[model samples]
Target: MFTSLRLPQPVIDQPSRLVLRLGLGGGLALAAAYGLAFAVPHVSLLMALLLLSKPGPALALGKGVVLAGVLMLLIGSGVLLVPLLENYAVAALLLIGLGLFAIFFIGTRQSHPLLSLLLVSFTLIPVAGVQGQALALQVVHALAGGVILGAVSGTLMHLLLPDLRQLPKAAPHKPGVEDAVWLAVRGVLIVLPVLLLALQNPALYMAAIMKTATLGQQAGSLNARDAGRELLGSTLLGAGLALLAWLGLSLWPSLWMYTLWITLALCWLGLRLYRILPTRHPPSFWLNAMITLVIFLGPAVQDSASGKDVLTAAVIRLALFTGVALYAWAAIYVLERVRLRFHPAGPRNGVSTC
Candidate 1:
């Protein structure tokens, strides 16, 4: 009976399995998010993509539940700051800065993507709350829903496209305390300015906060020499893909078409990210490009549905994202220079070992 129930295996290799998982899982997440009309639907798709990026078994049900709970708790914690932000603006900013530093420090010391999720929660939630308590609550719900959707889609994909063999995981490098501190400081500098700006007009700059969060994670992995190319290049690549997708979807203008475009793009990027498609660019480049594509495309879709000027919004968002990327590159460069000036014999290869 078990043999009769087993499906034929079309994905035999690890790379093919990974690509299929990303494509199918991302499409399912995207379809579900928009089909159900969840608030901030793009976020759910983005979470799914992030989870699929890790080529391994799906998260267990028990762990997924715990992760969802923890994520909700962390993200909801931002609501507590709404009053503090209104009453003691200066103190609130300082406290947020310190929190950012600590989060980045922990991320640098331990190489895990959970840190990115934490950074996004810590940064985006409070900014949303500044606009209104209701909006903050909505964001919390959206984030928690995204986490659950990602876990479910990822689990389904893994079962459908299981790897033939499990590969041994590599041990990640941990930066020393001093190096971690420096990297953490750099990440804080990259994110805090944007967060402050978002506080001024949370509705307008909310998307920027998300982009900045991605930049902060990207900045942590890059050295000065490679920063500009990797940062700006990936942003541009994502924008170009978004444009192409928009044009393609405009011709068709249907939900299925949108999902198809997204799935195809993810498959292309996943091939590069998993090294199935040979390229000189690092996996980070492809990862960032895929993320940027989602971020850009999601908003455009919303604008169209709401009768906003999609083209104008896309152009403005592209410009804002470019500015953020430029700032991140400059911050990384300046910080690296400062570190070298003070510590003449420090490691010059990457921001942190991992």
Candidate 2:
């Protein structure tokens, strides 16, 4: 019926080229993600989703971008309601509880729970901290960042390969309901420490992230050695990239040149590590580093008014990653021992029971 349509033959004959093009498109999209996330306030949730879902095949990538954009818009509008709702703690708790309940009732039963989880978890909450016109600014920034990341990435993917729409679905893994719950519980447990850190020292956001990871059976279940190795691999990769970026900036002051050097270097490192890693651990780590480094550098380096001190921001990010990696390694190591001592049979024994 649609015989007038002409499909390009290049896509069928050269999938590799298509993937590469899409990946580059994905990279640019990720860059947008980094920029908007830090500049925007609460919309960081969408940024998190984009980072988490980037490894998926082309179809999933498209879905993620669309989902993120929709979420960004919804969240952007939702900010208007923040003023009507008073009491930050109460609002936060209510939103989180309702979001989780919705997830269990509606999201969990679905075949693709990850998307549901991302949307629910990220957009579920209202922005907290202050109660005036500033709220609008925060909301706009947050949603703007996420929306830009999603729209840009999705559009870029479409332009680069045009085949992302046709990618195959991934095979399903066994639904670990018990494990997920346990992991969620652990996540709750870990939040205590982060709360403590916030109360005691707000500067420990990175530490809070690592310490929180330790609270759950999710991260706990990975092989102890593998987890530690992964943390090291990922962190070192970030540090190396940061160093390279610093060098590039030192040599060539142009923002465009800096972007090219940093992006290419990070991608090369990520691809190389992916190829050489004995297991999937290093690749995962490298991927994490690549995602985070963009956030770490964009404003810190780009904002000329922030004393124009690139070295300081670079150092701060490096330290943050280093400290977090150390904590992550230690936590994973300890959890492994606990698993051995208590649930000797291993994670399959359900000792890492979420």
Candidate 3:
């Protein structure tokens, strides 16, 4: 009896340890993601995955990260005749067409799925002149940091969510032509918003429309009413976290503490919000405005950007950014709800084979 009991305790303890390690790893990944974005907010791998998939551990997660990183590096380096690939619109259209063909005929060869992801990433490549070696190096550095972070975070998540084997199977082992098309469509939808944003702001816009579009695709289709409920839950959680972090900053000038406090607060809010506000409703602009206020207030007070002056410049900048991001999310959420209500997508949610 003692020996049997010992086995069970060890088994239970092992997974728990793994979970802790993975979660820590994920946290580090998030930090790296944030750091990289500070330099070039476009193509943010952190926000990409966070906004899309359910957090979990999968063996392939690391591979996917490394693969994406290398691909981005290669493109940044101007390798594989990508730089010479003329006619930006023409080329993208061609690739989309080719992808469509692959979906129908080849039906997602083992290599197709990764290639599809690679193609999606290619949308970030500027159609202008070639990039210099220096630019390539910087891009590589940022991508490497993000990839490492994601690998660690994903590994940690795997530990926490140990039943990854039970992940939903792809639509069909055969070929997911419709699924791929849907993915491509999703990519277009996600990218379109950023593309428009870029037209509006040429300075800070990193031209990440494609990445955002792909992210929306990855978020999967919001078909049923439940889908709205989930986004509602997610947005509220993100909002609450953002608010708590602001509170911490207002209270003190500790960066690390603020970050940690916000992370925990977000987790708690995620659980609480999901349980309470279980329905998706259009959030009032006032609610968003309040969130925006907290974001600025926290940073300005915590950072002490204003020593001699009563008001800090950082507060102003923070307010601008917070207001924009919050409003954008709110608008997107409203649009999604509208789309769901009107056209109403069919029940086709599942992992993409291609």
Candidate 4:
């Protein structure tokens, strides 16, 4: 429940309030994550941005801590599969698939955005563990830290720029059982290939897992017609944004500059996301683009720090991301056609299927 604070009416009435909250809050989280030198600092930054994108009030500190603990517990649980993965690969893969479907089904039925986070942890932690248990533990720690960072940044933003008038929150749309099942299936198909690929080289495909997990969750909300544009288009837009940001950072390579650049990018996207900038695209489009931007840029930064060829690495990553998006688009098209053939009638209760 968001309550209005004693703030000026101008700030309350202007849509820029939400944009500012998203931009500033995200920037603060990014700065803190990198400043403290957390493992996979970009993960923390991405989590914070996602949290800030939610329309309602920030989670209380206590709840935030609890969420962090839950994230650690859930992600850390993946370590249990390491032995199975090494010993009984077939059974382990099947188990992971089942778990992914269950999580996607629950999230789709409930219309929860945190599904992306859960999906990432579920898919990423186990795969990373296959490479090494230490890497898996690091992934868990990074995600938990990200949750805490998100909570703190969200709370601070709310306090500093409280929404003086509470807007009516839209009731979440819950799909029918059949729709939920189909959507969850689509979500699984979108991620499963990438998950399998990541199992080969978890170190390189870690970011891909993150991107695919987001795509899987996003696919649930998209129709077949819009799947290509929303999925592939956003990936390209994000890649472009990351390229530009990397160029800007090159001009003045400093943490302060990096923070500023990221903040500016977030603000620009926030304008579109909050509808301050007119656009035909939905808010999810911009949100995905923002996530894409971070996903692309984070790895580039790591590559540069590790003395790798940034341009070549970025190009390769872009290609991989594009391939994943194209696959997601195709999966949606094929699945929707199959669903239509069987049912003849489309989704009931006005629920759209992918």
Off by over 4 Å in 1: 1-11, 351-354
Most TM-score-accurate candidate: 1
Which residue pairs collide, candidate 3? 22-156, 26-153, 29-149, 57-158, 190-213, 191-209, 191-213
1 versus 4: better TM-score goes to: 1
lDDT of 2 by residue, 153-245 (tens): 545555554544455655534335654443344334333333334333333243233323322213433456666666656666656765667
**Residue 52: error of model 2 in Å?**
10
The candidate that wins on lDDT is: 1
Q: Give the distance in Å from residue 83's predicted Cα in candidate 3 to where it truly belongs.
A: 8.0
- Please provide the root mean square deviation of candidate 2 (C-alpha atoms, Å): 7.3
Q: Against the hidden true structure, what lDDT does model 2 obtain?
A: 0.46
Q: Where is the poorest 10-residue window by lDDT in model 4?
A: 345-354
The 10 consecutive residues of candidate 2 with the worst lDDT sum are 121-130
TM-score of 3: 0.51
lDDT (tens digit, per residue) of candidate 1 on 54-79: 77778766677788789888878889
The 0-to-1 C-alpha lDDT of every candidate, in the order given, reads 0.84, 0.46, 0.41, 0.84
